[model samples]
Target: MQFKHPEILYALFLLVIPIIVHLFQLRKFQKESFTNVAFLKQITLQTRKSSQIKKWLTLLTRMLLLACLIFAFAQPYTASKNQFNTQPETVIYLDNSYSMEAKGEKGPLLKRAIQELIENLDPEAPISVVTNTTSFSNTNLKSIQNELLQLPYAPNALPFEAALLKSEKLFSNKPNSPKNLVFISDFQEQQKPFSKPLDTSYTLHAVKLKPQVESNVSVDSVAVTGKELGKLKLRVFLKATGPTAGTVPVSVYNNQTLLAKATIDFSETNVTTFTLTENHIPNGKIVIEDAGLPFDNVLYFSLNKPEKTKVLHIHHQDNLDVSYIERLFNNPEFEFSTTFLNNLNYSVIENQQLLILNELTTIPSSLINAIQSFIKRGGYVLMIPNSLANLQTYNAFLEPYNMVMQAGITSEKRVSKISYAHPLYKNVFEKQETNFQYPKVASYYPVKANTSSVALAFEDGKPFLVTQNQLALFTSPLNKTNSNFSEYDLIVPTFYNIAQQSLKTARLYFTIGEENSFDVPVAMQADGVLTLHYNEQTTIPLQQYFNNKVTITTTDIPDVAGFYQVQDKQNPISTVSYNYARAESKLSYQNLENLEQVQVSSAINTAFDTIKSDTKINALWKWFVIFALVFTCIEMLILKYFK
Candidate 1:
């Protein structure tokens, strides 16, 4: 028995004082008065035993009162059994994420959670088991127990919140019954919360998931390129998510035949590349047979033949700086062209995959509007600041779409901290053969602020390389007045990454960090069917959105699959020529740290009915009060009869 207020029992010590008073209440048997009455005085002493008996009776009453008072204060209660049950209906949310695959003392977490539910089930109680799989639904113990044995691992993802909400809604339908929720999962913090369940309404039983101690290696991402029908070049990101680093050999195969192979020097960002020599090989899986983690071992992609996306650069002026950009960007994918702003027509924004804003601070209002429209419609714009740059005017062009560049300078010393996470650094330098500093910008103008912009490069701890919300506007600080402007290393990768992003030929096969939404332009109507021809044979119809300019978002392109060519049959003008720009080359990888945030819902609170029990354990305290009442009535009757 547990006492809610056991300390109050100290008051029982007062019983001693009452006992003393009761003893004193016994009168001397009136022996002297009896002597005055001239007889029976001898018998007075004989009645002394009666006096002692009355004193003892008074003591017994005091003891009873003290016992009653102590019992009231201590408030002892028995642990409730069956809770005077209203037949509880419980919703058990099972955390079935990849992390749940970790083994537990009982068994695999999935089976253990199920077993725990079965053991905890009161025969009178009803329960629903949810695995958080896409097929999650409410099912009774008899109906789902057999199904649990055949539960297949879900491939999509752990949707913690969605599962919880579904549980809550199912429990809500049953009223008056006691509701309770039991959850089993790794309880990753990255998971989002579902409907907030009230504490009074349900009991929360949280089952902790076992920790992950084993090393893991996963494929963080993969990219494919070349415009040909089947000849595919693949770059895969192999991350050794384990505590220590190691190397692994990743091979690329077309069907069962080994096409190309590369030994990846492993790190957190373990990367390897291989080329499928022959073009027109549409479908195949590139497998990393020896990575520690199996989830990322193999990636599936459809390869296209040799193809490159074109980028036309329009510079404000043709000078040494502009010539360097033109030469660095001279490749099959990029058909480089440039003219003075005055010589170029306004419609150039419409024709080019990307436009370079070099040394042009003051843009024509029409050009600014065109650029803004292009940006909203998902066009790529790379802005390089110059000595005579107008920060206010440039910001005006980027302001609407969540971007601004303000820190002005002729130059300040800076260097690109190669973010291997960035596609630019992914496969470029695999193993560090030499301590190549690449190139350093002696001076730069960092973006004064960022809203939708992510600081890709830093200058004196300020953002020098910034990407806009959609990643469409890539701004860099190229203080043209700085002596470093003529260097090749400093300018090449910047143009390469930004230009590649614009061409849309480089298919990003993974989603890690947040990416901005950029325009996917095809001359098509809002409702037109845009086909993505991965190779010569496979064509996938892409969904479109009708905004100011017919634009499409790129968030849906996370999968590694065949090439695509968008086609709008209704509007013949809306057609995009399919091409592959994937550069197949293998390189060692950088060790990228895992994100600390848990990306799945914890499903902490389950849903159940609120059944109020008619009898509570608190009723035990009432027993002592009732005993006092009955004793008081008896004492009153006895006193009246005796008097």
Candidate 2:
């Protein structure tokens, strides 16, 4: 037996007052030997004995009534042998991920779970409710009822193992009592095998909610396979919950206008390709019709018209290598130009995206200063050394940047290895071929550098092509007399990539609830707040601008997937797209056989019943009050009829 308010039990001491009064009353009887002193002696003795019994009975009734009233106020309760003597601290973990949106037998899984929890919860016990993104701790079940009703599906999800560890920490400094952690979730298979062992001190209960329909299809992702003037080839990836194949309708739309539609014959393969004409549209989306779960059914994407790259080649005189470089950048995508060292204009270097120096014997001080300033402002430079290049002049220009040119030249070296993982080679080739011939150099400048990444190495383990920050270095000049590098297969991609990397473009899309950042190129002196505009509304995200680049970082993303424009006041500068995470697409669930170690329940009601049966608290205070009333009635009958 336990008293909820034990301090009130001290009222039982008041029983001493009735005992003293009864004794005083016994002594108050006068020594009356009045009428019938001798004749009434026998009668008096009988009366006194009967009266003494009555007085003692009345006193016992009064004491019993007072004790019962005190116990009633104390709220005494009897705990079952299996129950804890102290009130339990219960933590209920509610899964609010998108997976919980699936329909259950009763209704929505999350809603049904919450309703069952409230129905079976002990009103007197303290409870804590933990959701994927929020926590309500040290409160009663009734206090959080309104919050539970208003809960929405969260974009983020918590793994079962992480949720268990978080629930355990909530009871770290709490008073000694029975502790319990209850989980209500669909128990996705991906969340199996907890990262850490459960604390044995806590009683763990799992209420697994099963969805009525298990089939689900999602538009996983989209990738660009090929691109030309105004046309793009895209491959859409789809995934299904099960192997049962069925056809699905897929469509591409530019805003509300549908561009193309196709019926995808579902099968074991996950990828399907489609050719989409750009038609001058800057943004678009891919949609697939799916039932059950709809969060990942649409994918947002955007297309930016290729910008023209400005290239300026500075040389000592007209050479064949300079013409080769011009041919590489002569396409509509590039603004190519050439100038001699003596005819160079310093102001033109500021607007050029890339500056190429071809076989220069010496670099003047003024030109060197301009090149250094351009590199610092996010410009790229590619240097090709002359066979008889001035080693002192090259060293003086490159030493400050942690690079230098060697004094001698080597003959008969072949380009043997390529760094395929480098960003310059991203999407350049479908796959590397094993029997492709490499370019050979008859005589080349031996290169030396302190800190640089080897992009292309020779068969002799020498650095043929190296890069340091915005600078790219080739050990040998591209003339036919020195090497055939300018005429080989690697020439086109190498030069085109150098120019392509100079333009700073924002990514087309980002995943919600993840760290997303974008870079925007602006003038170093440009100052103003950048804002993101969506649905005719504007919001300012966290940003840092430095060195002509503005980096925007934010996690307060849009709830719906769509295209949003980035602007500085009124001029739209870039487009950004956001989509929901694909983690909850598959409807696979954890196997019941693997969860034998934990207490598992199929329904919320079953879980509630289990908790109730394990923690039994019988309220004895009401019974005590009933006994007090019965005793009072007996005393009243004795006083009225016996008299």
Candidate 3:
């Protein structure tokens, strides 16, 4: 019904000249009378009415022919009803993360999406696919869809908005108009806020995956192994959601050996803390009871023994804050060291894993250079400023990295608005059955942030918790000059977060969960070992390394704040792991209300589902042209031969 170029319709004006010429059309009737006139008069009298009607019909046919020619030149045809042209360049934002595997029809959410995709395809139309990739790639539609169909469903999730924008850019080569985009997913509430805007030029189809409410018992979280030697402590938490299942069975393993078994209840949140009697398990794994949701039933992880952390504490000449902070890392497993502003040994700051700059009234530029280099090489710094800490030195040290501290602001209003989103917050409540909320941002420093900086804590209305690149920083306005330290609860979690973030380095990092056997770059001899000691007794060997990493069963390593030693033992070369936490609480599904209204049903009829076959296309439009030709031909031969 639409025209590709409707403007050609003006060609109808060409018919005016033909009509004018016809008006002037005349024939000189030879006045041959007599006998022939008598016979002609009798014949003309009998057929005069029929002949007049034929003349008008012939004129109308000529006008129709002119109109048909003009219309054909205009290139008129049907446009796509999918908010764009029928031959749209489309990108399908397919949600294939682990979370997409939630049970639906016959299997999971992803299966339904696949089925719907097959049914809804605008036969032969271009379509690209996108999933949960850590970094996006630019690729065309067909190949992307093939890759998606090959991947299995999972429980992992990705940001909704990010994936859409990525898909848009990939299909940008198509004409600006008549583009197509489809988001096939379960519009979970968290994902709803990030939904993309509708594009009329690009037909948007939300092939939503239907959600059904189901109870989920997930391993909400687990805490660091142990703080001291022989403690070998751990806290494993279980969260019961939806309909309670009373008690669930849980088992754990070390390598292939079954270590412990227990029953977990669902009436409330459950926290199970147990110790590892064996000092060297090498690798560890945990298997929870299968509760229909198979993706989270068994968790395989690894751990490392405790190791010493070489710490550098910076302070003013007469400041006593250094001593108290220094006392926390005094255990032999930790080599506690100190320096005062312009006087300390520079080499200590370079080699140490932990750097603590205290109530320094002034900081020399030399330390600033050391701090910058240290962070660049995977060093962790903890800034606990007393009122006396030098604002100028702190600002200068953080300027290049885009973190700044404003001078001389002090108040203890209480820890008001806490940032529960940070890992620091998670670690503090890891052992509690119920998630513990931070009391309040007591009288403390207000933290600020830049683009790369993420707030990990807060006080008043400012950010007290922060991370830049991978470096972690916490600010406190306590006891600066007043010598009155407040908000002591922050001490443990702050240190815990520092240790965890500092020691984070992936054995191998991949954007997608579907991949296996990632390549490791650091060559390990056939039997050489790269060891990571958590405190004293526990040690983790880097089984392999390449491309700046190796394959590590994340849970097998100890996530404590310390220096890791990668030793080939025979050749004895060393490497280390900077802090990064593997588990994120954000993965926990909070909505008990199942997403049940999504269109994961049997294939429904839609404009996109039509397939083009010569038989079918010819049956309609071709018939129109055929009938038009047949009628026109009859009219033409009748006029030509009879006349």
TM-score of each: 0.55, 0.72, 0.59
- Determine which window of 10 residues in candidate 1 has minimal summed lDDT: 578-587
Global lDDT of each candidate: 0.53, 0.79, 0.54
In candidate 2, list every pair of residues with a backbone clash. none
lDDT of 2 by residue, 107-134 (tens): 8788888888778886656888899878
Query: Model 3, 288-382: lDDT tens per residue?
Result: 77454555555444454444556677766674644456556666546677766667888766566667776566667877787877876556777
lDDT of 1 by residue, 1-643 (tens): 6677778888878778876776576654442443265456555655676656654664576478568868877877774433333455667777654445545565556666666655545433356766655333445666666676666544333455665666676665545566666655555444353223444455555545554344555545667544354445667765554464466667766567878777766544466655665654444556665423234456655444434445656567545366667677777656677777778776656666677776675777778888777766656777766656677787777667566665655454544444456554456656633354434455555454546444345434555466664344434435444645446464566667777666544233323122323234445544556444434453443343433223334433423333334445433222222111111111122111232221222222221111123223554678887777776666565555532
- Give residue 329's error in model 1 in angstroms: 1.1
Q: What TM-score does prediction 3 earn?
A: 0.59
The per-candidate count of clashes, in order, stands at 51, 0, 58
Instruction: Give the Cα-based TM-score of candidate 2 against the true structure.
Output: 0.72
Instruction: Give candidates' CA RMSD values in order.
Output: 10.8, 7.4, 9.5
True-structure lDDT of candidate 1: 0.53
Which candidate number would show the highest TM-score if scored against the true structure? 2
